[model samples]
Target: MAGRVVPAISLKDYESRREEITKQLVEAAETAGFLTLIDHGITIEEIEAQFALSKAYFDLPKEIKDKVPHNLTTNNGYEYYVRKHFPFLAVLLCPIKGPSTGSIDQKESFWLQRNSEWPSDEDVPTFRAKTLNFIGKCEDISNKVLTCLSIALGFEEDYFCKAMDTHQPDNLSQMRLLHYPASEGAQGTWRAGVHTDIGCLTLLFQRDGEDGLEICPGRESHSSFAVGDTFFPLPAETGPIVVNIGDMLMAWSDDRLKANFHRVRAKESGHSPDRYSIAYFNTGRKDVIMQGPLKKYPAITCNEYFLHHTKIQFGHNAKKKQEAAAAEKPSVVAATA
Candidate 1:
């Protein structure tokens, strides 16, 4: 069914049958890049409250919001009143095109990272308190989601978490808030373009009733998405979050877990105000180069692929070549001298 909408999982069932829930999550992720999580223990009131706060922050005057510009320390954090031009995170989450066409996504998003500095009582005041509370709660939710992922992947619940901690203080996890304004005339421009997430995994909390996210089947032979050539529109559920595998997770899984391509169209509903969603992304440590298992699939370096992707963006083909030469020069000199 190209246009078919699937039913979502029930929270009550999820809570009651923990083992079964874990299996379903594992199978869904292994075959399909995405799954709708129910009984995730997050409440409707909490989702609404987070959305309300996001709206309040976004609704502020553009000038007022622009004070906190995107910073590298924050890594594109706090983008206000604009859609995201850096669609790699979005593209990397899902790769819609077989060969990437380089058409960037057209949605605006705000990025937030964990605060490294101890806040001065007066510097942020109440805002700091609210943000910390919100992020702390969401981080817990994200960790639980990761735990589920561990169970599904046939690994210890702490496997990914502990491996990720190898590069402490600068973990790859991130929180992104999106606002999709109604696009009445824009026929082709999607809220997001077809791409894969660059990191390991992603958990999304979206508005309860609105539906826009669509997923394509996996490209691998065992992929669930391989059943069809068409896209599957995600069914809306009240207060449940959508979980999806990303490139990094796929890398970790030795290509067993697919990071399929997906896209979001501009909201068609005239009645609904702008759509708001908060997504958390997890990443592996920078120092640890990702290497897939050779027993299962061909061995490939995660860091090499990632560096290649980033280098594509920066026009650093020459620099990369030079670095490669430099790396080999020492070995050559050692052999001779």
Candidate 2:
């Protein structure tokens, strides 16, 4: 089966259906690595507003958008990574390349992290405030799902919740706004490259028929890319948000749940020119340490594992130690407001 849609889940009435919900969640995570969430309490109207905000922000003049450059030290703000300007080191592992490996993923993004600087409401009137509420709702829903996942793994309901420390001051959870422009008939190009998320869980919102997302299910190892791996097209229903397991959760489950590899517009599937989506990554508090329930993996701070994993998977040039420290420390400086 392609990506399946789990029934609507309610945090308020959680216990009544805990067992059933846990079973479904576990099965999907172990086999499909992707699931759609329905009746998640956050309405489609609310999500559409967030999507509109993403569009408004990206539509800004180049000067206004570039003012907020996303970099290693400041993990938030706008990132304009023209596929042509990519560094050689970063492209070594990029599977599909043109005349040069650097020119592969053509995309633009805006990242918002917990307690990080945000564009003022004046810039995108009421966006900063509304989006914060959207983030809160997503975090709440993610915690509820984590609760069920813990039960599925035979741990206390709050085991994963406590490890996430969602309310902590230095939480690394983020809600990212992404826009993938049309390929313009550009061959051998993608909106985003093949990569796995670096978190415990990711809640993704995409408008139906505005599709480009693809997944290689059950393919976890970064070094190996197989042609026969299951490449599934996402179910792009208008009402539901997609959810997937990430590296941290995969490690926490001792590889029972795989960190699925995915890419956006990686093929000539005739995707729409304008694609917009929101991804809320539950990276957990940088200080919260994690290990598999069976001690199958060594304990490491969330921050440490994230940076280390990104370095190996994406070949990021940042020093691991410095990146880990940057994740925890309060802003001495920020890329933008």
Candidate 3:
């Protein structure tokens, strides 16, 4: 299935429709694994303002932006497009016959980590405070979502909330802003490659009119071939913030809930305007381990699991290439001989 749209799952008056909304949430998580959220508490104006602020940062000159190079390890600061970071694009989009020429597609992004080190600049003096303010709202929504999931699983309302309390150290979730430049005729390129998120859940906002996000159901859909017919545009962002279960949630649910594969296009055929999105990746402390309420899964700390596994999902091909190159290199013994 492409994606489901569940209307007005109220964040207010929870006592009124707790079971009703819980059923919708669980059904979407199990089936489509992706859903458009409405009545999520964050207002359209706030959403617009956040996007505008992100746009301002993104519009700054390249030299100015480069002041903060990305921290690949933590995914903090700015990142210039590198094909390997999005492995599925290399495998799928690059081969589609466009400007890519089998190389990485270009996109730029900024990641904001809660209470982590941040860059200060005169250009966007208010950037830090405003962004943080928006993220605070995002965290509240995510917490309520955790509660809903607990209800869906037939557990006490606070079961998941207590398990993933953000106040605890190492559990800080993050928000990321993405900018996809308008692409003309391209050989083959992609905005984001096919991959599943490693966090507990992801809340995505597509700038009002832009379209490029695509998703495929189930974990297996991330592989090369399955991406063709199965992939479809996520419902447009109008009044709906698309939400999906991520890998952590999948493991915690013993795979009862899914973390579906999703992607963004490198170019939208002939689109002229840039595409922007804000994504909140919901997760617990890094130290938190992957485990289910039923104890049906083995435990691995969130950081350890995502580092070894998430990178593989994003750049499995790149890793394979490195391995191949290493194996093919002539040994010192052979060279000396």
Alpha-carbon TM-score of each model against the true structure? 0.73, 0.85, 0.81
* Deviating ranges (above 4 Å) for candidate 2: 1-13, 82-104, 220-229, 266-271, 320-337
Number of the predicted model whose lDDT against the real structure is largest? 2
Which stretches of model 1 miss by more than 4 angstroms?
Answer: 1-18, 72-74, 80-104, 116-127, 151-154, 165-167, 221-229, 267-273, 293-307, 310-337
CA RMSD (A), model 2 = 5.0
RMSD of 3: 8.5
Sorting all predicted structures by TM-score, with the top scorer first, yields: 2, 3, 1
State candidate 2's TM-score.
0.85
lDDT of 3 at 119: 54
Worst 10 residues of 1 by lDDT: 328-337
Candidate 2 per-residue lDDT over residues 58-155, each given as its tens digit: 88887888776775664677877644223553344344444333444567888886577777676778877888888889878888889988877777
Q: Which candidate is the best by TM-score?
A: 2
Residue 320, candidate 2: Cα error in Å is 8.3
Q: Give the worst 10-residue stretch by lDDT in candidate 2.
A: 328-337
Tens-digit lDDT string for candidate 3 (1-337): 3534333345556558767777777888886678777787888998998898889889999887777776554556787775544434445532343333234545788887866556575877688888889888887777777888977766678766665665665554778888888878642356666567878788888876677787776453222233343566764565578889887788778777878776676444455457888999887555655666677766766655665555465553445534543454342321100
Candidate 3, residue 212: Cα displacement in angstroms equals: 0.6
Candidate 2 residue-wise lDDT at 231: 52
